[model samples]
Target: MATTKTVDLILDAGMALVAGAGPDGASVRAIADRAGVSAPAVQHHFRAKESLLHGIYARAVDCHLEVTAAALLPVVLPHAERVAEPARQGVIVEMATSVMQEWLREEGRATLTSVILHLLVHAVRDASYGDLASRWLAGTVTAFESVGVAGTGDAQFLVELLIGAALVSAPGRFRCENDILNRELFRSACGARDWDGGFWLERYRTRHERTRPDSDPSGEGEGLYARLLDVCVALTAEVGADALSYRKIAARAKVAPSSVLYHFPNRTGLLMALYREVHRRFMLAAGTEEVEPRAQAAPAAGLFAKLIVDEMAGEAPLFLTSCELFLASWREMELAPDALFMRLERGKMHGVPQLSPSERQRAHLHSIWSLGLALTQYSHASSHRSRDVELRLRDGMRFLDD
Candidate 1:
C-alpha cells in the first residue's frame, strides 16, 4: 500500500506537471514518472486520471479560498465594528494587496485556478455538474459572509471577478489587453494618492495608433471602416461570431446593409476587421507611451485589475459585456489573439533596467506581487462596501511614482 506521504508526493508531482503543461499535459505516465513510481503504482493511488484531476481541483479551490479568507478576515472584522476609518481602510487595502501578492507567487494557486477554469467552462455546458457548482458557489459566498462581507450577489460578483482575473492572468495562457483596465482598478482601490486617468487614456490612445493598420490617411475610407469595425465588435459581443451577420451590424450601427458590405465585402473580412479592431483597442488601452513605460504600466495593470473586481462585484452591465467578450473570444480564437500580443508586448515594453535572465525573472516576480495585490478587489463580498470603487480609482493615480 502507498504511504500517505507517497500519495501526497504523487499528487504534488501531478500538480506541478499540470501547472507547467495544463491538465492535458499531465498524463498518467508522466505523473507516475515524476512521482518516481511505476504506472500501476500511480493507478493504484489515483484509480483514474479523472479522479486525480478532481483531487487536484478540489485542493486548489480550497487552498485559494482559504488564502482569500485569511486575507480578508482582518478587513471584515474592522468593517463590522464600524471602525473602517481612512487609516484603517488603508491598512486593509495594504493587507489585501500583500495577501494577493503572496497568492500570485504560489504556483500551485495558479495551476489550480487554471484547472478550475477548465472545469468551469465544461461545467457551464454540463447539467450534471450544476448541483456541484451551485454548492461550491454557495459555500464560497457563505465563507465570505461569515468573515463580515455580506450579500450573496456581492459575493458571487466578487468570486466571478477573481475567477475572471485568474482566467486573464493564467500563466502562459492568452488574455485580452483589458488586463490593463483590471490593473488600473486595483491601483484605484489601494488608496494610491496620485491616480491619473489622463495618463492611462493617453497611453491607451497611443497603443491604438500603433496597432491600427495603414489606411487611407486621407480619411476617405476611415468613416466606413470605423463604422463597420464598431458594428462588428458590438454584434460580436451581442450574439457572438457565428450569429453575427452584416445585416445585424447594419441595424445596430444604423447604417445601411449595403454600406456595411461596401466596406467589409464578406463575413471573413468583417471578422478579421473586428478582430483587428479589438486588438487595436486593447493595445491602445494596455500599451505604454509614457516616458517611463514600466512605471506607468505597473500602476495601470493594478488599476485595471481593481476595476474589474469592482464592476463585477456590482454586477454591472459593463462587467457582463466584458465577460461576454471573454467567452466569445474562446469560441473564436481569432478575436482573442490580442492576449498573446499583449503578453509579448508587456514583456518587451517593460524590458528595461537591463536585467540578466535571472534578474528579469526576479523583476517579473515583483510585478506579479503587484498583480496579486491588484486581485484582492475581487475577493470582497459587500456591494455597499464597494461604493468606494470610484474612490479607489481616484486614489490610484495619487501614488504614481516618478
Candidate 2:
C-alpha cells in the first residue's frame, strides 16, 4: 500500500511540474524532488522519464474523464426531453453549459486537461496509449445520454468542441483574452444578456459604415468578403477570441471599414457568412472522398483535428466569431437549429469508423471522451506549450489515404 502511495505521489508531482512548465519543464529529477522521493525510486515505477510522463498523462486523462462524466449527470433528463421537443433545445444547451462551467470550477481541472492533452499528443504514436484514449472517449460519450443528445456524431463534436476550448484556455492558467472571451461564451451559453446577436451586429455595422473605402484601381469589392474572412482568420490565430472587430479586421485586410460593411451588411451577416465560410473551408480541407470501411473513420477524426488546429493556429477572429456564434445560438436556439444540430452531428459522426454495433451503443460515451480529450489538446496548443500536438494531429491522419 505504501509503495502504491509513493507511486501515486510521484505521478502527482510530475503532473504538477508539467502543468506549470509545460512538456519541456517536467524532468525526472525535478519530479523526484517535488515528490520527496529519490530519483531511483521514481525510476523504479516508471522505468524511464517517458514512461513516467505517460503514466502522469494516463492518470490525468482518467481524472478528467471522471469529472466530465459527473458534469453530465445533472442534465440527462432535459437532454432526453429535448429530442422530442425542439423548443427544449435551449434548456439542453443551458444544461450542457452549466455542467461544463461547474466542471471547470472544480479544483485541479485545468492542470488535468493540460496533462491529458499532452498525453493525447503522445498517444497518437503509441497504439496502447491510443487504445486507452479511445476507451476513455467511448465512456464519456455514453455518459451524455443521461442528458438526451443522442447521436454519436453530435456527442463527438460536443466533446471535441468543449475539449478544444479547454485546451485553448486550459482551466486555471487562463490568459486575459481567453478569460474575457470564455466568460462571454459562458454567459451566452447560460442565456446571459451580453451575448445578444442583435447587439453585436448593430455594433459591428455602425462602426464599419463610419469609414470610407480607398480608391484602389482594382474592383476590390469583388472578393471583399473572402478577403475580410482571411484577415479575421489571421487576427484570430495571433490573439485569443477577444481581438475580433471591424476596425481590426479592416486594418488587417487593408480595406476601408465601410467596404467591409457594404459586403457584410451587419455583424450578424458578417458572422454568419464567416461561419459558413469556415464550415465550407473546413469541409474542403477535410475533403469529400468516400473512404473504405476500414479507413472511413480516419478522415473524419483527422478533419476534426485539423479544423480545430487551423482555426486556433491561424488567428483569433474566427474563434472570436465562433464564440459569438455560440452565444448567439444560445440566445436564439430556434433561430439556428440547423447550425447547432450540424455542429453536434459533426462531432458525433467523426468517431464512426472505430466503433462496432456493441461499441455503437456506447457511441455517445466515446464521443464525449474524444471531445473532452480534443478540447484539452486544443486548449493546451492555444494556451500552453506542447511539442507533440502537431505530431499527434499528423498521426491521427495516418489512416487516411492523402
Candidate 3:
C-alpha cells in the first residue's frame, strides 16, 4: 500500500532483496533505495544494521505464520459442520493441497516464507533471538493446542513440522525433493502417524533397500561407533533431524537395531552423539588452518569468514543438516548442541586479556549471527552480488571492536 509506514517499507524492501539475492542483498542502502527513501530514513527507523536485519526476520516470520494459517482456516471452516474431527484430518488433504498451491501462487509470500525459514534455522542461534522466538512460538503453540487435532501427541512438534514443511516445500526452489515433505506434513497435521518415518525415511529406505540391516559377526564391532555416527550424519543430510529414528539409523548403519543401540541405547543418545560428532568436525575445520599467522591472529571474524567459505563450498550438506538440528532443538525447548558446546568454547575464547564482558557477549552473538548468515547464503540457489556480500562482511567486522 502507498500509505505503508517507513519501517514496513524498509522491511518489505529488505525481504525482497534477500529473496532475490540471498542474505548479502539486504544492505541498508539497497533497502533504502528500494523503499524510495534516503539512507538516513532507514537509520532513523532502525538504528543499527543488525536491528534492521532482525526487523526483516521478524516481519517475515509473522507474515508466513499468519498468512499460511489464515489460508488453511477458510477452507477448513467451510465444511466445519459436515466433517467430524477424526474425518477432518483424512478429508482435508485436498483442502491442504489447495492452501499449499495458493501459497505457491504468490511469489512475494513464497520468498518471504523462505527468508523467514532461513532466519528460524540460523538467526535463532543468537541469544538475541530468544525473546522473539519464544513469544512467536508461544502464540503458535496456543493456536495448535486450540485446534485439538487428533493424532498430534505433541502440539508443539506438529506446529514445527507444519512450518518446516510449508516453507521448505514452498514452490519453485526444490519441488521434486519437497513433495513428500508437503504430503506427509499435511497428513500428519490432520491425524496421520509415523510422520518421521512416513515419506522422508520411507523414501530413503526404499531407494537403499539393497543395503539390508545386519549385525556384526565374530564379535568384531571395533569401528561401529564411528560408522554409526557417519551413517546418522549422512541420514540427517538427506532427511531432517526431526524425521530421524533409531530404525532408520540402524537401517543405514547396516547393523541390527540392537547393535546400533548398544552404542547409543536410545534415539536421543544416537542423536546427541551424532550432534557432538558434527560439532567436533566443525571445530577442527574452523580451527585448523595452514594459512598465514595473520588470519589465525585476528579475532573470531576472520576464522568465521574462512569457515563460511569452506562450509558453503564442500561441506554444504553437513553444515545444512547441522543447522537444521540446532534449530529444531531450539524450537522444541531442548538444550541446543551449540548451547553446550559454546560453554566450553567460550571459556577458551575468554582467555583473551583485552576482551570486555560486553564485548564478549557481542562476539558470542556475532558468531551465531555469522553462522546464520552463512547458512542462509548456502541455502540460496545462487550468490548475491559481490558488493552486497562485502558490505555485510564489513559491517559485521565492527562487532569485534571493544
Candidate 4:
C-alpha cells in the first residue's frame, strides 16, 4: 500500500511536471523520478497514467478552492449578517474585483493555473475527463457561492470570467493596460454598472487585419500549406498540439514529411500558424453584424445559439482547437503573447464597426462569454443535439448584459 505521504509526493510531482512541460513531459516514469520513487511504486499508487492525471488535476483544484475560499471568507463573513440584499450585492462586486486582483498579484499562481488549463484542454476532448472538469467547475462555483456570490448564474459567470482572465494574462506576458479591462469585467460579472473604460480596448490591436486563411503574406506554397494546416488543425483539435509532429501531419495530409518541415520549420511555428488559421475561422463565425445586442436579446441569443450549435455539431473546430492551443501555448514561452492576443482581442471584436460604444464593449464581453460557454459545454461532456444546444445558448446569452 502506498503511504499518504508518497501519494502526495507523486501528485505534487505530477502537477509540477505538467506545469513546467505540460502532459507530454509528465509521464509515469518521469513523475516517479521527480517524486524520488520507482516507476512501479508510482504505478502502484495511481494504477494508470489516466488515473494519475486525474489525481493531479483533482488535487490542483482542491488546493485552488481552498486558497480562494481562505482569501474570501474573512472579507465576506462580516458582511453576511450586517448587509441588506443590495449592500450584499455591492460586497459581491468588491469581492469579485478582489479575487481578480489577488489572482493577478499572486506569485506562482499562473503556474498552477497553467496546469489546470492543460487538464482542461484534455477535458475538452475526452468525455471522462470532461466529467471531472465539470465537477471541478461545480465545486469551484460552490466555493464562490459560499464566499458571498449569491446567485448560481452570477457565481458561474465569475468563475468562467476568472478562467479567461488567467489564460489571457499568462505569467509575465500580459499587457498592463488589459488589467483594467479584467477588473471591469469582474465588476460586470457581479451585476455592477459598466465602468467607462474603453481605452484598454483601443490599445489591443489585432495581429492580422484580414481574417481569411488564404490571406497569408507569403503566397508561396498556398496549396500544400493549406493542406498541411488543415491536417494540423484536425489533429490538434483531436489530440492537442503536444502530440503533433511533422510525420503525423504528413501521414494525415498525404504529403511528404519534408514538405511539412519546409512550410513550418519547427513545431512552434506550426502551432502559431494553426493558431492564426483558427483565429481567422473564429473571426468569420463571430462576425455576424446582423445580430446586435442593443437591437434586442433575440438576435444576440440567436447568434450565440448558432455558434454553440456549430461547435457541438463539429461544424466549427475553433471551439476545440482554439482553447486547447490557447492553454497549451502558456507553456510555450515564445507563443505566449500570440495566445494572449487571441484571448484578449478575439478576432470578432475588431471587425464589427457597426456596434455602439457600449455595444462594442459588450461585444468584447460577449466574445469572452462565448469562449467560456464553449468551455463549459465541453467540460460537461454534453452530447446534446443542435436544438438542445441552441436552447441552452439562448438561456446563457442573458449574461451578455451587466
lDDT of each: 0.48, 0.51, 0.52, 0.67
Q: Which ten contiguous residues of candidate 4 have the minimum total lDDT?
A: 206-215
Give candidate 3 regions above 4 Å deviation. Answer: 1-4, 22-24, 75-88, 91-104, 146-154, 173-177, 188-402
Q: What is the lDDT of residue 175 in candidate 3?
A: 47
TM per candidate: 0.48, 0.49, 0.46, 0.86
* Per-residue C-alpha lDDT of model 4 across residues 6-122, encoded as one tens digit per residue: 999999999889987777779998999999999999999888899999999888777766666766776676765545545665777677666656555536555666777776767
The reply for model 1, stretches above 4 Å from the true place, is 74-99, 126-136, 171-183, 187-195, 198-402
RMSD (CA, Å), candidate 4 to true, equals 3.4
Residue 71 of model 4 has an lDDT of 61
On residues 355-389, what C-alpha lDDT tens digit does candidate 3 reach at each position? 44333333333334454345433433335523333
Model 4 regions lying over 4 Å from their true place:
81-90, 101-108, 175-178, 188-194, 206-214, 266-269, 291-295, 312-317, 347-351, 383-392
In model 4, pairs of residues that clash are none
Residue-level error in angstroms, candidate 1, position 119: 2.9
Residue 389 local lDDT, model 3: 34
Best by TM-score: 4
lDDT of 2 at 97: 66
The all-Cα superposition gives candidate 1 an RMSD in Å to the true structure of 12.8
lDDT (Cα, 0-100) at 290 in candidate 4: 50
Clashing pairs in 3: none
